[model samples]
Target: MASVWAITLLGPARQRRSHNDDDHHTSKEEDIDLGPEPCIFTSTIPAWNCRNLERLASKTVSPLVFAHVRASTEGALADSNCHPFSRGALMWMHNGGIGGWKLGVKRRLVSDVGDRWFEAVGGSTDSEWAFALFLDSLERLGVDADDEVRQRDGFGHVVLRKAMLRAIERINGFIAALPAETREQGDVRCLLNFAVTDGKSVVCTRYVSSRTDEAASLFFSSGTSWKMQPSSETGKGAGKTQLGTGEYKMERRDRGADIVLVASEPLTFERDNWVTVPTNSVLTIHNQTVLIHPILDQYYNHTPSFLRSRGFAIAQGQTAEDRKAAITRENSAAALDGTAKEVAVA
Candidate 1:
């Protein structure tokens, strides 16, 4: 039930040089590849290690970087409970928790997985267990979760996306099978924002299992480069380091996205730089192209005008005010009529 503060950084791959492209005078931003292995860091007290983390990140370069800071709702403070859990080259992280996990879903999910995945769990956390489930899902799709070649090359975006969706489906099934009384005694709805990558293609989800509740807040920014802006840069303002000395900006030198970032919240206060990933949809970042696909299922909101409440997401540690322009007239009317309370911003 912990609130996972996660960040996923995807650096564009090295494009093979083509003779004709050089003659065309096309400028391409290349991500400097320092090594093959990804650099991952996790902490229960990130503030205590901010300087060390920053130093490590400054020197390391990889195609993908996944970082997590856990605000515990469950499990003891330990390294094994930290996220961006990895198996070979595949890395996984979750921002939300399994609904009614303690009520029975955990036991059911644990019992259903094979011994390999079951034994792979080294920590007492829903996030790590969820990763194990994802690995099991990949195996069920006929892909070896630990294949050396696939680990190096990647499991491919299509296969990884399918496995992610299947894992979510299985989680829903487990929650559904809970006894009726148990389900009634507690919230059975899940806020499942998951990200998985094979150091190549990355897939992320912003999903909630209820049609009337918004999922945990997730935002993404993509551009040609993530550049540092001058401190004097104007407007909404740039983000600062803990020392408050510098700022950063997402610079779009061209239409192509050479850098992609996904996070539970906007990394900077520059709201224009980020876009909210639609609820109940999977976002795929492959080959520097960002694609979003709806998760078609029973919990999907078929009505475009329906407004989902953020109350549930807020209670679960994610909060976002619905834009006034996006709220439908019907919902606005209800709010005015006292049927629904207006969301206030201080």
Candidate 2:
């Protein structure tokens, strides 16, 4: 089961896609400006109507953006199991599952959150639970998770980044608290590729709980416009082809990024147009500028030119053709914030 979520922040033309629909074949949306750009729309039907979505996509244009299509690893098929869960102006989504979710990790997570966040979890997936934990972390940090003021004024990218890191830390705590027998025999390393946005700034993380293993795949592309080639040149129609099938390029006429895109995989075969968000790092897209910050934790490996095994991501069908080469940059994880030669992500 895959889930899709999109937000289009536009300076001139902004509209929100609502989750409520009148029927199976029809979709619903509103033109009211919520001051947060738009409401996230999601669907969980096994079959996707690409044409319908393309029609909607063609009509809407955005500036600040985020999206996700999830393949569940630990939940039943249902609408609530989709990505892009929301509360007020905040939207969240996750790729990958909690390690030891079946061994009472989910219970531990639920028990740790407050009553409001706990009762708000509508899905049974660990991904949604992680979102609740994120809201909890924000509240604990003195930021009101449900306050409309923060939503309108923007939950600073730094705030979201710290809360996201703390949420992952809490998740690690849950897995660590599992019984000794469960820990000894279980596959406890988690892949937590997370994305969160409050309609202004965006923050995302590509991480794994193990130092030597790779997390699920995450790639980012930044440029002026995500334009598609003429169908005659690439045999792919522009704006008509669905997300991953379109032949697209990042037109870099200048250094200022007019558009920023992050995906579980590259949407096109354009290699120079995309860069790998270094594993165990946080990527922030604020003011259309991209910043990469390494996640320093116990699972963080600082070995220069260290290679992470692709076996885990491969098993989940998330491997890329140049997967091994993605992390070949010389600077080690520990030196991300220190004195080290910087590697250009684009």
Candidate 3:
């Protein structure tokens, strides 16, 4: 239920870690290069602290960065509960909650995962527990979630996506296995919008457990560069710079997508610059190419224009609506300018 936001940069930049307890402490700063440097940088700060967030942003440099701002819903207000949970080399962020978490899902999920993952949990948030489940999923898929070599070399996108889908399936099973009366008394449907990365590739999902209901809103934007638009003060003086001061838009100079952005909501109000990730689907960004694969299951809705109710997502504090209703045709046309392909994955 915590509202989360993340940004992934595919090129080189400086990486830094800022802790809430050490606001006055000077954290170590290192450049993340393609050769031997660490691949992921994460910053978890309280959503209300604008000054600290600005200070952290000013010193950031990384090709891959995930920033999390926490709004406490299920966990105590503490730094440990802040998101972008990392284990080994993988990072995770979730914008939705597991259905019926307090009823029986929490106890069942805690007992279901392996001991290593269970003990590795550092916080009391269900979001962190979900990350543990994802790590366990990777292990069950014949991949070592903690292997140093694989962590540095990268877990292929295919493997990560498979694990993501498997974890969702397991979550659904937990909800379904609840006592009949408990399931009847509580809302057992899940609104799972997850983002995970192994530092080289990113895989995100916009999924709902009920076929008739829409998933939480997840939008993506891709282009050659996320450039700042011209402003009235540009080129006016030597000391003035408009890089971060002006509005920015996705600029497509070619077919290849040098920049890819996936977020829980449209980063900008420019509707033509964003495209909605279809419901019940997995979106993968690897080597700058975007691929979307449908998550076919009992909850999958095959209709392209299916009108799903937004009541559940709205009540959960995340909005969900039809693409046609949310984005303009020009936006869909702009999406075609990038290198996005949809391949069937059964």
Best by lDDT: 1
| Model 1 agreement with the true structure over 52-148: per-residue lDDT tens digits | 5666667766556676665775578776787878786788888888899999999999998889999989999898898999999999999999887
Candidate 3 has its poorest 10 consecutive residues by lDDT at 34-43
Decoy 3 TM-score against native: 0.79
Q: Pick the candidate with the highest TM-score.
A: 1
User: How close to the true structure is residue 10 of candidate 1, measured as C-alpha lDDT?
Assistant: 42
Question: Could you give the candidate ranking by lDDT, starting with the highest?
Answer: 1, 2, 3
lDDT of each: 0.79, 0.78, 0.77
lDDT of residue 266 for candidate 2: 83
List, residue by residue over 287-311, the lDDT tens digit for candidate 2.
8888999999998999967766665
lDDT of 3 by residue, 120-209 (tens): 999998889999999999999999988877777788999999999999999999998898999988888888888888878989999999
List residue ranges in candidate 2 displaced over 4 A: 8-37, 46-51, 233-245, 322-346
The deviation in Å at residue 322 for candidate 2 is 7.6
Better of 2 and 3 by lDDT: 2
